[model samples]
Target: MKFEVTILGSNSALPTTKRFPTAQVLNVLERFFLIDCGEGTQIQMKRFRLPMSRINHVLISHMHGDHIFGLIGLLSTFALQGRKSDLHIYGHSKLEKLIRFQLELLETKLDYEIFYHTIFGTNIQTLFEDDSLIVQSFPLKHGAMPCAGFLFKEKERLRTLKSDMLSFYNIPIKNRHGIKQGDDFICDDGEVIPNDKLTKDAPKVRSYAFCTDTAYLPKIVPIIAGVDLLYHEATFLKTEEKRAKKTYHSTAEQAGKIAAEAKVKKLLIGHFSARFDDLKEHLEEAKNIFPNTALAEDGKIFSVELDRD
Candidate 1:
């Protein structure tokens, strides 16, 4: 039961000597979510031994080159590797045309089908879901046409019957499912066994939110409130707050403000400006408000285990 996030790239627009661009890997259950593929994202995946085939879903925050430049390369590699599974991509409406243009220019035909869901509104809507997890997107103010932040939540878990309780009560093996589902078993002799005495409550659901390339907007607080983990772009330190606003990006302090207001459990900030050689200022600025903040670095992996209590 591991739910984790791996940072592949953390640089904002330009690639620095220490960082790449924007890319993150979200591992929920057994599914892989590639969020905002930037340059060299495929290489990072290979370095980390992440299975490209298993990654069928990609969520692009915006159409900026730093966020989506690596998509073409990744798709090309998938084709080269002879992938045959249908892939689904969620992003703004222009993504369909943008990707189609590249494919058309290259005259490349994918062996797999590519499904695109273009997000155009500012509502919190479920983009896709499976038995284990659900993914939703909400609009962010990135000054582009429309950029979105994504949320991934694990599905509700079922209770597991304690083996000791079952063995102590001499419960039949065939009735385990019923017990786990809170159903009491009635014996042939008319004996009743309460469900609470057999099983505990299910594990709490875990959630993660990705907010990038957005200005200091507190309106998104409600949408991502109480998320287990939050990844927000912190392109500048507090000293450069004006610059961040001019660029429609958030300062480290601003990112922390949003996380604190939203009451997120943990905050990871990335997309640092190229001017800063050291990231201590960014971390300190965020920690001043949100003590749980961590500066995002390339190749850094953060694993999140949900608290059952």
Candidate 2:
């Protein structure tokens, strides 16, 4: 029932003394998902004490070294550790080639099979979905390499049963699930009990969005609107707006603008340029527009509570 993201590395292309490259782990009810494995991602994951073997799905934003350099190391480690579960990776087609090429060069065979899913196009696409969670990949406007942003949405939970009501009606345990799922309960005597009288409202659906290595593309706002938490890359400050535009990156101010326009409950700005010795200015610029902004610091955890605002 837990939903949260752990920031592993928050720096941009370069690894600074204070921060590593871009990486994160999203845990949705113990399903670990690795998002954008950048340099030193393995070390960061170990430092954070996340169970590396539990991460079955990996999402790569783009083939940029800063975004995917650590994938080979992670895969190699999995082999070394004798992993058995089949792994899945989602990204541009080239991502699979890169990993396969490296593995072939090493002449090392892994015990687990890897399934590479091609997620292309400049539109939103479903990557993974289950009864409890759905993960979608949306295009990120970052050059022609075909980067992607991700959206994680938790499905609406069933209603909580009213204990007193259940006992009052002597509802059978076998019928409780249907009652929680909004089905009316029929007594043994053929009396119908409205579902609302036996159960409270279902928990609200929650969501999180991850946008990185992209420009200020407002089109994505619709896809990520009203997300409980949004982690958008802020690679520079407004002072370097032109550079950010040229590199297809976003400034902290621009990140804030997107958050404000999207109406997300909270915003986390990261992917900081190595040139920045301190991130106070970056936080300040983003907060100027979206007051609920926080820096995506390394090892920081951002949780999406079930309650809706």
The numbered model that scores best in TM-score is 2
Task: Report residue 155 deviation for candidate 1 (angstroms).
Answer: 1.9
**lDDT (Cα atoms) of all candidates against the true structure:** 0.89, 0.93
- Against the true structure, candidate 2 reaches a TM-score of 0.96
By how many angstroms RMSD does model 2 differ from the true structure? 1.4
Candidate 2: which stretches are off by over 4 Å?
188-192
RMSD (Cα, Å) for all candidates, in order, is 1.6, 1.4
- Put down candidate 2 lDDT per residue, 61-90, tens digits, no spaces: 888999999999999999999999999999
Give candidate 1 regions above 4 Å deviation. 170-174
Q: 227, model 2: CA deviation in Å? A: 0.5
lDDT of 2 at 156: 80
